[model samples]
Target: MIVIGIDPGIARVGYGVIEKQERLIRPLCYGCIETSSHERTTSHRLHEIYTRIQVLFAEHSPDEIAVEELFFTKNVTSAIRVAEVRGVILLAAEERGVEVVEYTPNQIKLAVSGSGRAKKEQVQDMVRRLLKLEEIPRPDDAADGLAIALCHINTLR
Candidate 1:
């Protein structure tokens, strides 16, 4: 099975693709979609994210999409923007005929690090170890994206 995980945000949307065959899971690709502050409108930034994610869906042909659900944020504006980004992501997945699964931040952390209250570094380290990567995936968001996917994969087992 091929799974694409998303860490949604307005300015930067992180994504990771992984392939699972039976008991094995391997990384395919991981990166982020970044929009400039000069985009001038929130809708435009969302459009950019949506368009790029659509391309990713077409290219990767993922069987499922695992997305991180929104947790509380102190900044209401940022939270709303991120929620909008997540909606765009779900729409893209629906268009591509991919089943979408959502997981909370604590769920991901527990699945990745065996601790719901694990620190970011602990989860990142676990992601690197589980994926057998030489280094932690660059950009914190990308690593978080991978963790989301890994969480889903572990849950399936």
Candidate 2:
């Protein structure tokens, strides 16, 4: 089965694609969709994310999409913007006929690192070890995407 994990945000939306067979998990691709502040409006940025995510779905044709649930944020404006971006992501998945699964940050950490309060670096390290990668995935957000996907895969087992 193929799974795509997402760490959604307005300025940067991270993604990772993985293939699972039996007990083996393989990373297919990992990256981020970024929008510059120079963009005209939040709507335009969201449009970009929506378009890119649709293209990704077309290319990967994932069986399921695993997304990180929104956590509490001190900044209300940022939280709202992230929520909007996440909505666009869900819409893209729905349009593509992909199943969507949401996992909270704590759930992800617990699944990935055996602890709900694992540090960022600790989680990243575990992702690297689990995937047998030479090094940690670049750009923290991309690693986070991989973590989310891996968390879901583990939960299923």
Candidate 3:
């Protein structure tokens, strides 16, 4: 099975693709789609996100998509912007007929690191180990995206 995992954000949305079979997981691709903070309009940024995600869906041809569920405390504005980006991602997946699954941060950490309260470094280390990478993906967003994918694959087991 091929899965695409997303860590949604307005300024920088991260995505990872993985292929799983017979208890093995392989990283296919991972990267962040960045939008400029200097943009004068939020709508343009959202449009860019939607268009880029649509292109990614086409390129990856994933069987399913897994996205991190929104979680916020003490920053309603940030949460709202993230949620907007997530909405575009979900819409793109739905339009393409891809199955979508949502996971929480704790759920992802637990599945990837064996603990719900695992540290970022721990999860990154485990992802690198599981995928046999030389180093963890950069900028944190990519790492989180990989974690989301790993969480889905682990849950299936």
Candidate 4:
């Protein structure tokens, strides 16, 4: 089965693609989609994210999309923007007829690192080990995206 994981944000949205073949879970691709904060309006940025993700769905044909749910942040404005981008991601999945699953930050950390209270480095290291990567996925957001997918695949197991 193929799954794509998303870590949503206003300036950058991270994505990771993975496949479960037999007993092994492998990473296919991982990266971030970035939008400039200077030239675009928030709505335009959301549309661009939505469009790019739709292209990803077409290219990957993933069976499911695993997304990290919003966590409370002290910055209300930033949190709200993240939420909006997240909604756009979910809408893209729905339009592509892919099933969507959500995981909280704690749940993702637990599933990926064996501890809900695991630090970011721990989770990233676990993701590298689990996916058999040579190094931790670049750009912390992308690593978090992989963690989200790994979380879903582990849950299935």
Candidate 5:
């Protein structure tokens, strides 16, 4: 099975793809989709995100998508921006007829690091360890995407 996990953001939407066998899970790809502020408007940026995600769906043909649930933010503006990005991502998955699973930050840490209260560093380390990667995934958000995917995959076991 192939699963794509996402960490949504207006400027950089992070993604990680993983392949799962009966008892193995390995990273296939990981990166971020960047939309510059130079874009004409928020709608334009959103359009870019939507289209890029569609392309991703086409390229990966993932059986399922996993996205981190939006957590509470002190900055309402930041929260709204992330929400907009997330909306497009979910919509893309829906249109492609792919099932999506959502996991909270804590749930992801628990699954990836065996502790709901694990630190970000610990979770990132665990993500690298679990995937048997030589180093932690880059661009922070990409690692976040992996952690989110790991959470869902572990739950299925």
Candidate 6:
């Protein structure tokens, strides 16, 4: 099974693809979609996000998509923007007929690091260890995306 995991944000949306087979999970791809901060238009940024995700769906051909659910302690504005990005990702997946699953940040952290309250570095380290990668993915968002994918893979077992 191939799964695409998303960590949504208005400025930079992160995505990771994983292929699972017979108890093995392999990283297929991981990256962030960055929008221009100087563009002076939120709509343009949103359009860029939508278009990029659409292209990613086509390129990866994932059977399913797993995305992190919003968990905001504060900053309602940030949460709303992230939610909008998440909606765009879901729309793209739905249009392509891909199954969508949502997971919380704590759920992903626990699945990846065996602790719900694990630090970001811990989750990233475990992701590298489990995937047998030599280095952790950069910019934090990519690692979070991979963690989301790992959570889904672990849950299926």
lDDT for model 1: 0.92
Q: Show where candidate 3 strays beyond 4 Å.
A: none
- For each candidate, how many residue pairs have backbone atoms clashing (under 3 Å)? 0, 0, 0, 0, 0, 0
Please give the distance, in angstroms, between residue 70's alpha carbon in candidate 2 and its true position after superposition: 0.6
Of 1 and 4, the candidate ranking higher by lDDT: 4
lDDT of every predicted structure (CA atoms): 0.92, 0.95, 0.93, 0.93, 0.91, 0.90
Where is model 2 more than 4 Å wrong at Cα?
A: none
The residue-level lDDT of candidate 5 at 78 comes to 83
Query: Which scores greater on lDDT, model 1 or model 3?
Result: 3
lDDT: the better of candidates 2 and 4: 2
lDDT of candidate 1 over 61-132, digit per residue (tens): 998899999876699988898899999998988887789999999999999999999999999999999999
TM-score of each: 0.97, 0.98, 0.98, 0.97, 0.97, 0.97
Looking at model 3, the pairs that clash are none
Model 3, 1-157: lDDT tens per residue?
Answer: 9999899999899888999988778999999999997934889999999999999999989999999999998999999999999999989999999999999999999999999999999999998999999999987898889899989989888
- Residues 1-157, candidate 5: write the lDDT tens digits: 9999899999999889999999989999998898888836889999999999999889989999999999876989889999999899989999999999999999999999999999999999999999999999988999998888888889888
lDDT minimum window of 10 residues, candidate 2:
34-43
Clashes of 1: 0
Which of candidates 2 and 6 reaches a greater lDDT?
2
Prediction 6 TM-score vs. true: 0.97
Better lDDT candidate (2, 3)? 2
Write candidate 6's Cα lDDT for 1-157 as tens digits: 9998899999889888999989778999998999977945877888899999999999989988999999897999989999888888888888999999999989999989999999999999998999888999987898888889989999989
- Estimate the Cα RMSD of every predicted model relative to the unseen true structure: 0.9, 0.7, 0.8, 0.8, 0.9, 0.9
